[model samples]
Target chain A: MLWACLRFPQLAFDALRGTLPNTPGAFAVVAGPAQRRGIVFANAAARGAGVRAGQAIATAQALCPHLCLLARDPAAEQQALGAFATLAWRYSSDIHLREPDAVLLEVGASLKLFDGWPALERRLRDEIARSGFACRIAAAPTACAAQVLTFAHDGIALTTTAVLQGALAQLPLAQGGLESATVTALHGMGLRTLGDLFRLPRAELARRTGPAALLHLDRLRGHLAEACPRWQPPARFARRLEFESAAHSTTALAFPLQRLLRELELFLLARDGGVQHFVLVLGHERGASTRVAVGLLAPQRDAAHLLELARVRLERIALPAPVYSLALQVDELPPLTPPHRDLFDTRAQGGLDWPALAERLRARLGDGALHGLACVADHRPTHAWRHTPLDPAAPATRDATAPAPTANRPFWLLPQPLVLRTAPQRILAGPERIESGWWDAHDQRRDYYVVELRGGQRAWAFTEAGSRQHWTLHGWFA
Target chain B: MFTSTADLFALDSLPASTAWPVAAPATTPASAPASVPAARNTAALDTVLRHPGIWRRRAPGTSALATQPSGHAALDALLPGGGWPRGALCELLVEHDGLGECSLLLPTLAALTQARRRVVLVAPPYVPYAPALAAAGVDLRHVVQIDAAHTDTHWTAEQCLRSGCCGAVLDWLPRSDYRELRRLQLAAESSGTLGFVFRPLAAADQASPCALRLRITTAMNGTQFELLKCRGRLGGATSLRLRA
Candidate 1:
């Protein structure tokens, strides 16, 4: 099986840098127990000023007086690595996450789908870089070999087992992924490179360094099987971002919100689905968390569009307190159906579609502000029509089976019939009786007539049965 | 060079410039024919007439404006383009409600909805009776109603008109100024959608930026329409015998 491994050499620095709004200044990640704290990774600005990794924090500060030191966060690093794996999940399903630094994917089946290795490699590199991560990639015949090759060199591709074996032999014993104690013991035996150890007899090597070292060598050489648990994306997406400091205004939260949205986008891509509804919980410094729920008419995964919708919704909310952290949770992700496009679609390019426009209007207005009209196929004028949710996919045609009204109907109907105190100037037409809803409790027996008001406005006036004096203005012919 | 002042007025002595029609021929080279300059002038005039802002009357039975028929023969004859102008805002100033105001637009709205184009009603005063609309041949599924506040009525209509997905946006604005009408007009023009705004008759005297404005009142036999402002024609009035 062909395997591709991506190693993040500066994962600690990269993970922390993504959280900050800007990283133009000199920065370094210092980790280790309190007394031996040293620079694990230094950014370009610090490196330009002679700051190097593994140097004590004091020495690094001396080299660059203004170095901004951040303690290494292992949780954030693992989260960053999982995000990268989620991105690579689009390329292959058989993915294994190596602790601390690397991830391996069996890309044998994906090579054909991606038009071979070089194309896939270029795509992986471009996407990873766009996601704000620096990675060293290598490929070999086995997963373990591929992981080991990443330390030796970046962009190494060994297709066959013989070639992989030959390449692995040239690497120093330190890059063999062995424990430091075992490597020290092997070094004491005059073994400079992996090829020197390979020349020794198997029984003798196992007697000297124990069976674990032999198993490691055998796994790297494709002799023993390496079983790593496959990483599965969670059923639901829930990502949280803790602010370096409490954000007072909503504007201060836009950057972290955007980063979380980007991660949500990658997560949706991995699942090959779209989100119709998601909630953004703003963790405040005091009181309960504020929840901003964004609902769309259709499933959507575009980050920019989602961001715009979220921003519009956020503007209407009043922050109860300064937000200390933010969380994005999407419980239900429906399958996305790509819109159908004709060869010559007359729609304006880059203009919002119907669903997007409706969402934008509803984002500003309340949810119940917009509705569609549907004929209810009833005899009562009030019960003849109902408001429905606007669905663009439904055909814009009425049911042909419903019987048409014989009498003339007014264009506008009042929500409640208004009582007309005075009589009309003239009657245009006689009463067309309507006695409907007998089976239901709303029994009505009314005689409707077309009447002309004093100022020459037409009205739909109706009177109860056996009473012609009590005329009620039910509708307007506007 | 030492000639009298009268020599400057002479046709032959006048400097050869396009501004002076008589001097243009003298500036022409001997190799070119006389028809070239005349053709160039006609081409320049054609360019000016091609602009949308420039209104020019065309020959009878050869109209150049894009319009949707109002479905009434007499009313269509009174309009400049033989019907309602497309891609522009039209204002209907009603003397009062139920003066055949909704009937005036039922035909055009029906035609648009039948073609599967969306028609949005923003802040309508009353419920648009579905039975009447269905009998009028309007597709019910294509009709969307938006209930917005007084402040957001114009904004919602402008957005629908500019969305390009809508074929018509009908709005009822109880109160609005010239700036709001101007914004709606621009949005309709950009998206090439029909926009109809209904205002009270009192606003008829106020200057509006809509492409067309009509004042509807009741006549002896039927409804009367006075064309207060049409983009390319003089004001005229017509009466139609429409059913209530």
Candidate 2:
């Protein structure tokens, strides 16, 4: 299999930097114990200021007094690797995540689908660059060899096993991805490159550096197939972004939220599905996180539309405390069936669809703000209709066969019946005796009448069965 | 030089079946046939009449404006195009709520919903009775009710109108100025969706950008309508007895 290995040489620095807004500054990532913390990665600005990796935190500060030293987070680095693997899944399904920094994809099958190796490579590079990662990619017949070549060369492509062997021979022992102890032992014996080690007697090499080193060499040469555990995408998508500083307002969180959303979009693309419900947890400095639940009427995956809905919801929320991080978790990604389009149907050609518009309204006005109307088979006016959630997938299953009511119903119903103080001028049409709802305990035994007030406004008034002197205005014909 | 209006009318010799010209005829050559200039003038007239914005009195029914019958014969007779104008905002200034305001447009809303087109009700003042709407032959499935706050009513209405997914958007704006109405009007025009804005009768004297505005007040038997503004013609106080 033709495997492509993507190595992020500065994953720790890039992962943390990506979470912050774009700004030019000397930054360095320091790791190890607090007492012996040293710079593990230094950005270009820091390197220019005479700061380099492996320097003590104190020394780096002395070199560049204004340097921004961030503690290296292994969790963030791991998350960045998973995100890259999700992106690579779009190119091929056979993905392998080499822990800490690299990912290998079996692109031999995908090359034809993407119209050959060069086009596929270009697309992969473009996606990597757009994701803001410094990646060194190399291809070989074996996964181990591809991973090793990434250390020796950035963009080397070895198609055949013979060419892969030749390339591996030129790679220095240090960059051959062997155990450091074995590399040191081999160096002590005057072996400068993998080619010198390969020429040694197999029994002698095994006796000197143990069998694990020999096995690694065999896997790299394709003599022994590497069984690296294939990476399987998690069932649910969850990504988090930590702010360099506490975000005092929702507006300050928009940029980082956008990045997480784009990553979620890529994740959805990899899964070939859409998300109907997701939650954004706004992490505060202490106590509980503010959770903003975003739900859609239908499955959606478009990043811009999702961001718009999220922004509207974000604007309405009052942050309890300054947000320090943001995490987006989307469970249950349903398969998306794109709306069918007819060539000649020009209605809402380029505008938002009905579901999307409804979602936006609901996002701003709260979930209960928008609803569909459904008529219930009840005699009581208040119980005659119910509010139903708008479900676009469901067909209009209106009960057309239901018998029409003999009496005319008013167009508008008041939430509560109002007691009328003045008497009506004349009676128009009702006084239909209605007695129902005994089963639900909301029994009503009233004679409803259509009456016209002094101003000629038609109103629906009702009186208790025994009392015609008192009338309650229940509805309006308008 | 063509001086009299009759002379300009006399030069209209192009066939009625001629297709609309794709582009305005370039500057006519000096030595062209004498009839060429007359044909160019006729072509220009055709272009003007074909514009969707323009209304022609002679062929009122033939104007390229979509309309839905208001279901009242007397009211339709008074309205331009013989019905409620589609793809344009229609304003109804009500003296109060229960003067057959909802009944006036119930027929058009029913027709839209029955035709499988969605009808959005944005921040309606009251809960529209479902049984009455169903009894009025409105498809309850296609009716969406959006209960937005007073501050967001105009924005919600504009979004619904501009989406083009809804066949009509009906909103009640008790406190809106002319600029807000104009924005809704433009959104409806662009998306070709029917928009209805209901306001208090106090704003009847204010200028509006709607295509039609009718002031309804309680009459002897039913509701009386005074046409304050209609896009194509000078509106008159045409009274019709709407059934209660």
Candidate 3:
């Protein structure tokens, strides 16, 4: 019934400081791109050099001369975080991403099951080490207490009342963790110890220090709730495959994963669906396995498309250890009915040979490679098409009326026209100018037509209302 | 007959970007032939050389269309008529020329634009080209057109059809297979638009997807266009053509 909050105290900055040398110099990690490589992902090294967090890159470099720069690999940290989460998940199901850089673990139920308080704390610390994170771990009976302890004692476990009291007594209230003026008031009152604040009557404290001051007292005493939102569990399309013998080779692991993947596909298929996003659990080595998750830009049903996308990501996945079992999970998927508008039309025209076709195309061409053109709701002929992920059932939109070109129009438009007739010109046919805009830019112009000699070919073209010089080839009579 | 190594050495200089300033204009190689060049098309299109898989399967497998047999043996035999012209465009008009009635053409249109072919419905009455075409295995990518003829939709479509891009072209105008139809038919013959006219559901007769004409309707699936006005040898329609 109770939730335990475990927290990491300034873990990112602390991790940076412990590693970086103490020099009055700024250093940054430069990993991803060629230019502006020095924008600090973790800037604690520069902080000591009077280069504050979020300071301009130029200023940071100017302030600190001998900065030990490592390319900032968010991908690397993200990857490390994933491995960390899997290890953390083994400790508890209630895991929240406080960002890829941090996590929140709810371990109230875990404490009782994992032996007594000290043992539980040791186990949590051991698991953090096991995950390859030189992490600072803090825990308390209350989420806020654990959170405060994590920040207060730099990851020391909070258990005994004296230890808890000691931790809370020294923790300062800042950034609403402790309100302003209250700290000043407390300073003026000469009350630095939370133990000093603890002695005041609860009602008197709320009245004298102002209502906000009560929050610090409440949080320190575990009266305030841990305000972090809980993670939502994904819908279960997950099925696990347990083997009698633990498999270690890639092919063997793939066999089990593929089987689970098929079931996941069929389950999603039965739901008339496909998964664009999913999580993976590898519990093959008897409760010890890696978990890799992926979020796709587009939802897909075809297994190959998902697999190739998986492969690009998985190639980077060096297995933490060998696999024994694998679990495939899919989330947030729309049901994929037989590629038909009406569900009942078993006799509907053309069986979904196209989806079969769609599957093949998705396989050979990377998922992102073959995209259907989504028409942009714009009057300009060139801006008419956009590459949208091919969703057969995507709602078809009716195009608004376009201005009838006064010039000869071509069989196909070359996306954008090198505006030949920029200026307004006289017309041969009726002057019909089309101007439309709601979600996009409107071209309000009286399109007039004129014929001009280009490369010795008489080209039909159109011009805007005011400009008369820009003329574009509309089409050939041929 | 050749190994990869042998083939490489036997060839002329390898294709490379480095020699572009000089090698760019050497006889404009397309005028001659290469051994099945994978790359063909305008240089500009090359900038957006849409990877091939989306265009079509490298080699189309068995045509997905299961075209039902038309009564006319000669025509049915000409087609794998059990299915429409798979992978090819079959244009149908709303007028009868030599085919007895528009009904006769249904099975064929049903066949060519059938489920296997992935039909593309060009121009039709505002009824948003029938979904029933799908039942026929017509993989019509979409029902799109510059319905507004203000621009050159016809010309644009002509280019598309001549490019052998779609499975068919269905123009609903009252024009019979006159000069342009002849031009289009000749154009279709090589480029692949299996042109047919759906003469005013009750127009005279013509020759098309089927050799015989029939009165086809939603209520009565398909009936023979018993009175034939054209299609010389098998001029008269005597039997009911099945609509798949």
Please list the residue runs of candidate 2 whose C-alpha ends up more than 4 Å from where it truly belongs after superposition: A9-73, A129-134, A162-214, A221-224, A234-253, A273-291, A318-342, A345-352, A396-407, A422-424, A466-469, B1-34, B50-64, B95-97, B201-207, B234-237
Give per-residue CA lDDT, model 1, range A1-478, as digits (tens).
8999999998999888866768489999999999899999999999999999999999999989999999999998988888888888999999999988998999999999999999999999999888778899999989988999998899989999999888888999999888889999989988988888888999999899899888989998899988878998777899888888888888888888898898888789899999989999999866469999998888889998898889888888889898999999999989987766658767765456688899889888878888988777777778888898876566535567655744478999999999999988888986878889999988889888899998889999999976788899999988
Which 10 residues in a row give candidate 1 chain B its minimum summed lDDT?
B1-10
Task: Rank candidates by DockQ, best first.
Answer: 2, 1, 3
Clashing pairs in 2: none
lDDT of 1: 0.84
lDDT of each: 0.84, 0.85, 0.47
Screening candidate 1 with a backbone cut-off below 3 angstroms (N, C-alpha, C), the clashing residue pairs are A478-B102
Order the candidate numbers by TM-score, best to worst.
1, 2, 3
lDDT of 2 by residue, A220-318 (tens): 999997776789988998877777789999998888888888878878889999999999999987656999999888898889889999999999999
What fraction of the native alpha-carbon contacts across the interface, defined at 8 angstroms, is recovered by model 1? Answer: 0.76
Interface RMSD over true interface Cα atoms for each candidate: 1.6, 1.4, 16.7
TM-score (all chains, Cα) for each model: 0.83, 0.80, 0.30
Q: Which 10 successive residues of model 2 chain B have the least lDDT summed? A: B1-10
Candidates' chain B TM-scores in the order shown = 0.81, 0.81, 0.42
- CA shift of A430, model 3, Å: 81
